[model samples]
Target: MTATQFRCLLACLPDPLTARVVRLQRYVLVSLDCTGCQEVGVLLKLALLSARAGDLPAAETVLHLAERTLRALAGHDHTFAPPRITRLHRPRPRPARSAAAPSPGPALAGQVARWTGTRPLVAATDASWKRGHGGMGFLTTDGRWGIGDWKVGPQDPTGPSKIIITELRAVQLLLSTVEARVEMTVLIDSLPALSYLWRWQSGDVSALPPGYEAPHLRLLARRVADRPRLRFQHVKGHSGHLLNEAADSLAAIARRRAPGFDVEARASDLVDSFLTSWNQQISA
Candidate 1:
C-alpha cells in the first residue's frame, strides 16, 4: 500500500492513541533499511507529532525506538550520506533581515509568560555555518557549556543547513541538560529561530520547519509541551552580551574543528573575560 493509503487508514482508527502508535510504527519500518542520521530524524518527527497530538505514550515509545536505533548503529563506520527521503521539499527563502526587525509579536509575550518563573535558569545558544559545516554551542551564566557539529556527514547535497536549524539543535542540547519539570530560560540571538519555535509550540505544525531541522524543532516542542515552564528570550547578537558572545565563539570554534572537537579541554577564561569586558563597557 502507498504511504498515503497507510496514513489514511491510520487516521480512520477509532482511538487517537492507537492511530498515533501506528504512525510511529510506520516510521520504525522506514528506519529498518535507512542507515544514517536521516533515520533518526524521521523517528524524531514522528515523536514530535505524537506529542503535539497529546499522546505522550506514543511519543515516548517512538523516542525510545530512536534511541535504540542509534545505539544499534553506534559501532558502524560510515561517512556522511544524503537522506533517502521520498520527497524533499525545499522551503521558500526567508526575506533578508530588516535593520529594525520588529520584536516578536505581543502574542509571544502571552505564550512566553505561561512558562516563565521569577528567576528562571538561563543559558545562551548560538550556531555557526562555514564552508558547508555547521556547529552549535550553548553556555549558561553559571558555567555549564555544550558544543557540537551537525550530523550531515559532509555529503550535504541540500547545501548548508539553515542557521535556524543549528540554533534549535543548540537549544535541544542545552535543554537536555536541564532537570525535567523545572522552569528554565534560554537566551538566543536569532529572531527567526525564536519565531519558528514559538509557532511550533503554539500548535501550528502543519508545515515543516526550514531545512532538515524539523526533528530538532519537534523534539524541542515536545519538551515544551511536557514542561510549560520553559521560556526562550531573544537577545541582540554582537551587543556585547557576555554569555551570548561566549556561545557564539564556541560555535565558531566547533565549525573550524569540524567532525571532531573537544569541548572539555577548551579554555574557559575567554567566557569569563568577555563577561568582564561587557561589564566594564556597560559601566563606562
Candidate 2:
C-alpha cells in the first residue's frame, strides 16, 4: 500500500496500538533506502504519535531524524527549514475551586502575623538549563540569595523540559529560605512555574503537568497553601528588570558549576545601584 493509504489505515486503529505500529514502521522505513520528503513525513508523524503516547524521548529522536532528512534535501541552499515543536505534552485541565470556600480564621491570621513579623519581603527567581543539567537561583531585596543545581539522571522524572522543573525548583529554594508566615511577594520569570503555584493555591491537585511526578511538588504545594501571606507575581525575563537579571546571572553561573559567592559582600555594590535606580523609576 502507498504511504498515505498506510497512514489512513493506521489512524483507524486505537491510539495506543497505532502508536506502537507507527514506531515499528518507523524502524522499517529508516532501514530502507528512503531519503526523500516521504521519509520525513513518516518520521514527523511518528514523532507526533510518540508525543501523544507520552514518550517524549522517542518523539525527540524521531524529530531529529526528520530534521536530518530535511537538511540532506536542502543541501547548501538552506531553503527547507524544519518546523519547531515547542510543547510535546499538554497538561490536563484542572477543576476550579468552589467560590464559597471559607476564608482563614482570625486566629490563623494572628498566628501568621506573629510568626512573620510586620516587615514585608520581595524576591526574584530564575532558572537555567544546559545539556541534561539545570540551575536554580533566587535573590531577595534584603540581600539574601542562593543558587543550586539539578542533574537529570536516567531514573529522574523530568516532565517535559528540564527548564520547567528547574523553574519550580528555584521557587522551592526561595520559599525554603524564608519563614512561611512572612508576608512576601516572589517574582518569577516563567509563566508555567507561576501557573503551577496559582493552581496549587486554588487547591488543584494536578498542579504539576502530565508526565511530571516529582515528590517535591507535593511538599511545595503544601508549603504554598500554608503560607497565606506569600504571593507570587510574574516578571518578564531579560527586560531590564534588575532583580530578575541578577537572579538569571546567578542561575547561569550555577548551571556552569561555578563556585558560589557571597551575594551580600560581592553583589552589594551592584545591588545598591540597581535598587536606587529602581526606586527612582517607581517614584517618578
Best by TM-score: 2
- Cα lDDT tens digits for candidate 1, 166-261: 787777666654556766678899998888667766766533453453344565666655666767789999997777888898787666552222
**Clashing pairs in model 1?**
none
Tell me the whole-model lDDT of each prediction, alpha carbons only.
0.56, 0.60
Candidate 1 error regions (>4 Å) = 1-120, 151-161, 205-207, 211-214, 258-262, 272-284
RMSD for each of the candidates: 15.3, 20.9
192: Cα error in model 2, Å: 1.2
Candidate 2 structure quality by residue, lDDT tens digits, 128-212: 8877767777767665666666777788876775677789878876775666676888999999888888988887745676687
